[model samples]
Target chain A: MKLTESLSFRNIKGRPVRTAVLIALTAIMAMSAICGSLAVMSLRNGLGALEARLGADIMTVPASAVSKQDFENIVLQGSKGYFYMDRSYYDKIAEREGIEKISYQLYLASASAGCCSVPLQIIGYDPDTDFTVSPWIRKSAGGELKELDVVVGNDLSVFVGETITFYGVTCNVKAKLDKTGNDLDTAVYTDIGTIKRLIAASLELGMNDFKDIDPDKVVSCVLIKVADGYSVDEVLNDLNLHVRRTKSFKTTDMISGVSESLAGVSGIIGILMAAVWVLVLVILFLAVYMSVNERKKEFAVLRVAGASRSRLAGIVMSETLIITITGAVIGIFLGLLMILPFNGLIEESTGLPFLLPDTLHIIICAFVALAASVIAGMLSSLGSAKRISRIDTGVILRGDN
Target chain B: MTITATGVCKDFIRQGKNTNKLTAVSPTDITIEAGKLYVLMGRSGSGKTTLLNMLAGLLTPSSGKVLCDGEDIYALDDEKLSRFRCEHIGVIPQGQTAVHSLNVLENICLSYMLYGSLKEREAAYPAARELMRKLGIAGLENEMPSALSGGELRRVAIARAMLRKPDVLFADEPTCDLDDENTALVLQTLKETAQSSTAVFVVTHERDAVGYADICLNMSGGSIGKQ
Candidate 1:
């Protein structure tokens, strides 16, 4: 018969349990593919963000900070605490032969005060000497920052033109950076004058750590760009040898470490997706095969009513396509429900970057996932369709009576 | 329309070391003419259903041809043969042929739907309703086959075969499990259908059906005997 929607619907509805099982299996397959793709895409975007944010070839932090919190916490986590070395280290690194550019930043954390909504990490850099954050600030703000103006991260609640008070020192938000899906999303960027004023205000507010700190003579970290024809390793070695009481790190090395950590998770999800698809394919094959076997007499009756073998095969394939397409749509919807609203929670629990693709890309991926499931269903039903096409109408009819 | 079978026979290969072949139906020649009811009466395993299946173009004969009108039905390939049968031949298979998922009306119009002649349910509903009424099943059109009585299901199958009004109609034990009244009703409908241009063939062991047939043949041990 013509493979109409009514025909497929009735066939599936006739065998409720079989249809339910097949749909469930196909849904699981689609769900696994969607969730897996989401995770892999997020990780890939997060890694890209991390690489772009770390514009420096090498970074030098106080040796004490490395001993206290290790490399990952200081660089990857965007730790709020700050430790500093003598400002003379900047001159020492600048004097090196292969140093193309060098900039130093002061890191400070706001006290938990009633004036602020949350304690935020504040990064203070010199606009004239900085190559890392200056280009972004210029692109976003279109001009240099005033003494008390600040650029906020995308995740912050404060908006441009709003004033945020840190330790009783208020600063105007000049611009907000886009989300990078990393620690930078929660940081604040400003000129050195703004952070020095905040530290002085913290001292006035009776903060003990700020009371003894000297913002003028101290530097938190130094970012260096290697000159052409000079490797990052050579610059790193030179900085380590010349700059006393500080440790130098290659940004590429830190990124490599982050990628290694992600490899394990990506591997697990890949295996899971593959396993689910294989299991779904086998279950669908068996379900269709058994369904066809049970309905041999029915097929014979249709043949007697003048249905060709190809028509019988079409019926079987149509039923499979209906189930698979329904299951795929449902699965994609469920995957979205699980992933979209709770992405922050996922990031927190996994300690990895979670960035969902844009709506267009997500829709494309969903369609591809759905098409894959339909193709899988068609392949699984091929054997059953062949069997139905080759059925002996007269033999089955005689046997049925 | 007339169905002519010439030197038709069927054999089954029994697999073993000896490879012996068993003949299911011996060589037989017969002609079933239009506007007449023909009944083949036989006990179980008498090859009555086999011969009926051959006449309906459902099986390929080992030797010889069964012609419908002027063309050998078997000479057509599978696709052409199926189309030809859909347009000109109808078979009401034995016992419980009703599809459980479809209502009586859907079952009645299944042949037209299968052959792509009827695309919409509305287009076939009138014909199906009329046939159901002729077979005394007018009210059961909306009821599922599972809810129908044994005789009602039989009538539904009969209505389905007759909906297309094929030139040849084959019914195999259509009245097997029906009560006497239902059986007589079914036989009378078959007789009325035979009075039209359609040729009717009924394979049954029911002695009562003999009274409704214009020509009756008795079958025993794979051979046909005129009675």
Candidate 2:
């Protein structure tokens, strides 16, 4: 070590309590800043992915399901829910003037037994007409899904060539979809024919609530894309005015609620980060200032020993740099431990999609946080450095204040 | 080496309400010549320390000049003057003083370390050990300053001041915390340093210190005169 570094190190080691306090304060500041930024960025990324995955302008669900809020629970939270309207609704929606395309899906919630630990939301879409799930399936599965073949979400523990059973029917896992950072990752998807067989098996086992329901005659929901030059709101109004025993709403309306929750969460985190930074910076400033003042005689003695003013300042800054850099690295590592492993828990608690940003983004955020913490430490000690450098060596060494 | 101060005086502005400037030292001329022990005797606040500080290059006089080897020390900037002091001047201030974190040996070797002289540091240990042995602090080199008693700390300061073998050495109350045996030992070391051609100036209240002096001066009411 250089002489200045050795001196600074000894100064830090001499005051254990003060050193620990400064390190801890900077650690908290770094943790809050990094975790807060990651959380906000992940949420926005998850929301964006969800919007692209929806792949529809509007959705129509059974009036009963809408009234009971079951459709929201199923789609937004991946809760185990199955509500059906007549398959004729697909034809009815296709006949609407502003309708550009239409498709139907059947939802079947599986019991949390057999190969699954948690209940899975199984969605079956018509292979011939699906614009949303099929495109993703082609990307992951590489081709059309054969009979009894299933595509699993990223959160599923099952891998390709594995089989998951639902209601005594075993299905092959063809591929796994990428993460959407929401409850959608907990779902399973298949073609309409396979879901119909599962529905029939469920009905026979007395696992279904609707006893008279026929799988071939019912659809859980209808997804529609409006034609170009036609207003989505206008078409939505026409559906609600003409359709019977069902309700249609814009897909954006459902997303807005999630967006609002995300905004609230992000704001709370931002406020918390700001408050921690301000408090840490203030305490650091006062701590450094008071510490230098208390050591006036030591500095004066150093001056008597022929230390220049700038060298004295250099010693203080070196100590500050060591503490801040150490604290920032520790805090960032702890943040990764907390956020990376428990992302699902965070999503569950916040009820918001929580996808982590890409690797480069995370790395950049950590570096920025590290730099900010070091800057804060240096800035806080700047005043004290200047004050100590300019001490009146003669008066102080003479025992005059 | 010799330090010459001509028409040197100092004034401090008393802080707080009813503030006024007070002269700490009166304009005076003095020369500290090599190979002599000069003892300055005075009561507390008699400006003995102030004058000592000016000669040590630690304080700037309000008027006139202090020259060491034909260069005005006060005229140099902080960098140049501090380097000058490091190479030529050594000071032992009043009361206990140490870089508290460093051990006794490290404190004694601080003169070389402050200037980052790697070669000097390589040679400082043997020289420091010699000084510590002479001051009867040989076994305490590894101990911290806080672990030593007041007298031991005073000896450590003396050892540190002499480590660089500087041209001019100043001590304020160098024997304030020592027993008779240690006090004699310290005074003898100062006299020896003078005999070896370094100018040694001591500010003290002890009458015993006068016995070791080649020249004795007294200060009263901010003015200096021969004792």
Best by DockQ: 2
Instruction: Report the lDDT tens digits of candidate 2 across residue range B138-159.
Output: 9898898889999999888899
Model 1 lDDT, residue B227, Cα: 92
> Considering summed lDDT, which 10 consecutive residues are worst modelled in model 2 chain A?
A69-78
Q: Give per-residue CA lDDT, model 1, range A219-242, as digits (tens).
A: 888899999999889878877887
**Tens digits of per-residue lDDT for model 2, A1-401:** 46344788889888889989998998988888789999999999989978878888989999888877546758655656888889888788889889888898888888876633457898989999998779989999999999889998889899899998888888999999988898789899999899878877777777755466677898988999999999999999999988888889798998888898889999999999999999999999998888888888888878888899898888788888888888888888888788989999998788788899989999999999899988988999999998888888988877632
Q: Give the CA lDDT, 0 to 100, for residue A99 in model 2.
A: 87
Error of 1 at B188 (Å): 1.5
Give the Å error, residue A78, model 1.
Answer: 3.3
Candidate 2: which stretches are off by over 4 Å? Answer: A2-5, A67-73, A115-118, A209-212, B17-19, B117-122
Clashes (backbone N, CA, C under 3 Å), per candidate, total: 0, 0
Positional deviation of residue B39's Cα in model 1 after best superposition, in angstroms = 1.4
Give DockQ for candidates 1 onward, in order. 0.54, 0.63
